[model samples]
Target: MNGLPMVVSEPGLPAKVTIHEVGPRDGLQNESGIVAAADKAEFVRRLADAGLTTIEVTSFVPPAWVPQLADAEEVFAAVRDDPAVSPALNLPVLVPNMRGLDRALGLGAQQVAVFASATETFAQRNLNRSLDAALEMFEPVVRHASEDGAWTRGYLSMCFGDPWEGPVDPAKVVDVGVRLLETGCWQLSLGDTIGVATPGQVGALIGAFERAGVGVDKLAVHFHDTYGQALANTLAALRLGVTTVDASAGGLGGCPYAKSATGNLATEDLVWMLTGLGIDTGVDLGRLVATSTWMADRLGRPSPSRTVRALAGASAGEKQ
Candidate 1:
């Protein structure tokens, strides 16, 4: 498979893409059942073994806000102590505000992510603050995280369309993204929170960011597969030289703020496409499938990832 002919869809597709695995944090936060800290630790270890270098391990938000991740400290400690997990693995935890940052810092977190919204309505609903106020809230978090020498990521949600606002302008999205970058965020992840973006909208948004002097190197994409356009939109971003892509294992997350939003792009599905394109991700598709399948059993449901389903089905057939 390594010797396969390199296939470039466009003139300058990225030689490799970075997959930011967000399953343990973004994926599990939306889950109805609270996963045990030990289980979450095992999940992260499995992802690390599967070659997911950067995994969002957990969120430092208050338990009242996200009970599923209430055991953030325990989960982080467990994974940190596991000798089997690579020491080089980047485990980023979500830190919503100063309090969250304090908690993550106490845990000796090496990386953290702050989330904001592209539209005013979503901002008010998710963060309970206005657009400007939400950005202000993250300013200190990003600054302190940077000062502490921790890698910081800024997430801008509802970049394409908001449920209340309908269609979003690409210029507005770029402006919000630039603000996040200016706030000391090392990287900005533009999110299709409601999964409303198409390839054309994605291309336009990335192009606008580039025109605004925000290089693709400082940008990543987080697409939800609500409309089955996550992979398609990702392809568009990759063609534009956006290398970092955020996905969940087993397609296991949704936006609690945006009710219509569904699961994220599955890591297995993304890996299949990247491998087919001869793009290096350093991920093992079979191990990823096994991890997701194990997680799905814990959730008491089948994985939403088509790649996982196909692979699992083939494995079952072989035994039969």
Candidate 2:
């Protein structure tokens, strides 16, 4: 303790971590009731105001397939006109096929995402095809988007474990990740679809990617909190220099394939941990918690964030 400055010993983690909020797309997709277009726009606006830089605004799949997102075009239109959410930040839409991509491009989206699974069983259930066929189907979409200079993110679901297939091979994940990169996607998000990955497993999978010559900077992590391992696993990825993390506000998401699976890592929970560890997530914790509260109210449920619950309890006590 002699003579060393306190600031030198307690320096913050890195100054930047990109938070790709998937509340609007991933969160609402699995919801039973459809969220109104206006409500959805307001939700995104509130998140943006709370300092989320990159938001996954919507998906362009057909209405029949996902009735929850039937108002995709309307929601995109609303956000496009919103002064709070501007072009300075990004609003990446998930497009399942060329038609979805066309709709997204028409709405002036500068960024888009495509979805694929690492294992055959999940792929069949999700995309109704083999792994190779699903990847081949996105070729034209990726090619066109790249020509237009739009950034694309490819989601590789069940990178560590698949509910149907049990455990996923690390090399299989690498093959899909490489194919996506070769198709010109700027980033690939490896998902823990069932939320069963431990920190050690996360490190091993990330190490596999490193050995395959995949730059850590081009990777993102989407973790489910089913078993309460999301944040711990996230810390592991951060330690490996993977900066981007995908989270859903209000902890809203679950995999239909895994019955016991919980939501994506709560945005509020992740922000709290990052800020405490001196990591910069560019997200305001209090406002994010407020937004989650609002959504929980709308859905008639309590918030799932442990940090939010603790803060709320303290606030109530102070008020009393």
Candidate 3:
């Protein structure tokens, strides 16, 4: 389906937006039931078939830490050799540190991501290091990934508000973001890990980054849907000319570290809004909803995405 016309009243929005699909990795990582490597491979394949060019396939963190992605290498191998997979598809794996980066590189991963937190409590609890120390750990990882001819992405978690720390200062978020960029990260994804951000907070964060001399092009927004405001926050980002967005299929994942944090914004839901806004994403909404429905069945639950649920219900009614 084509995007709607841009003659409407939207302002400062990009003509096209890049939806970075993170279901296979971020979405599944929080699941209690472990999905087999082959199923994970099929999941990635299906997402690509649905025209998601950028999918985060897996993470190379230690198996003990995240057993859900224990078979990262196996999962990577399955997709990397698939003839049906697009050669130009970007399958970025999360590399927590040097060890994870080495594992990803060993598997011949072309892209990797490193994550840091804007809040000290989360940094200490999640990474087991102070914020500065965590960034220090990622610096070498990002540098080595770049040197290895692989693109690197940095994830700055708790950008808007942290569960432990009530409200986060946008300037501090920008400071952490700039450090990641200076460390050779090609792109930085600002994450609202606890999902407490409103549209005003989103705009303030983006504005701070822009004022700090960081281009919006180097930034992506990753919002959790816990507060039911992911779509609103995303629209705020889009209105400010930030094009890249990180989302999961079926709204599958949440921050395991943050007890209150919920699923990432669903890709299907995001696409529905973007298409209606006349923003080109090149994703087939029907196919995306179908893919999410299939995944929801695998997980033995209804999808968390409003668009997916509505579309599936309509399809069921039509069949009836």
Candidate 4:
């Protein structure tokens, strides 16, 4: 119940950081077993109560593609109707194409995102289209969504490396990113799909985006802890003025389509580091740990987040 880290704010980093929580959607989408829409709605309510302002609630893709989220409409409707879940909460959902967008907007979804790939192999594998073709596909989708005034984000996966195609070119990543931004996406989230990027590569990619005239205000970083570099890369991006970072509770959620994509940067772990650095994320650490623990029990597993495990265990010892 205490903020342990002394306020040692780094000079270059922002005073406040926005964590885009994706556990509900990204984390559960990979689950083979069905998580009931009721449980999913409760999870979203718990996250909002724990002070996560922006939670990716669910996806609008076909049930055939992500059967786990087949009840997206039900889940969204439940949360949208729940009195406890704040109306101001940003509940963005993933939409694969125009049809998906139509479905999402039909249910009164406001914030939506389109997923893209930095590598051709991943584009073909994930989207069943070439990299440029996928970007082209997103153009009209993004335009249509923007015309409706939906806050759209473009998620460019494999920004660092791909399993089928290794060592992604930063220029290539920037090209796709620029095209997506030009298509009127409000933000671009560069994903380290395989979690292989180090600090230098993270800085270089952001720098390349800068060279292409894209600033940090329009950028966010989505890193996986597969190689234990997520935090480090996040730090690098923070120093480069990236204010928004994507994370999942309990270190959950890899890509359902990309087997190589491992666990996302845990929200608890990211909060711990940000707290240590004197950065404000507006998350209650104690409640956040408990919320993750609650979800972990529901999932029949322990949370993978080092912070959640440590803090939860410490609190348990205190109770004893």
Number of the top candidate by TM-score?
A: 4
Preferred candidate (TM-score higher): 3 or 4 = 4
Q: Which RMSD values do the candidates have, in order? A: 2.0, 3.8, 1.9, 1.1
Tell me how far the alpha carbon of residue 153 in candidate 2 is from the true structure, in angstroms, after superposition: 0.5
Q: Which regions in candidate 3 have their CA more than 4 angstroms from the true location?
A: 1-9
Which lDDT value does model 4 have at 139?
A: 89
Tell me the RMSD of model 3 versus the true structure. Answer: 1.9
Taking the tens digit of each residue's C-alpha lDDT, what string does model 1 give over 1-320? 23223454555778899999999999999988889899999999999999999999999988988899999999999998899988888999999899999899988898999999989999999888999999998988988888888879999999999999999999999888888889999899999998989999999998999899999999999999999999999999999999999999999999867889999999999998898787889998888999999999999999999988988888888879
Winner on TM-score (2 vs 4): 4
* Ranking of all predicted structures according to lDDT, beginning with the best and ending with the worst: 4, 1, 3, 2
Across 36-112, the per-residue lDDT of candidate 4 in tens digits comes to 89999999999999899999999998999989999999999999999998899999999999999999999888999
TM-scores, one per candidate: 0.97, 0.94, 0.97, 0.98
Q: Number of clashing residue pairs in every model?
A: 0, 0, 0, 0
How high is the lDDT of residue 156 in model 1?
Answer: 93
The TM-score between candidate 3 and the true structure equals 0.97
lDDT per residue (tens digit) for residues 118-197 in model 2: 99988888888999999998888999998887888999998988877888889999989899878888899999988999
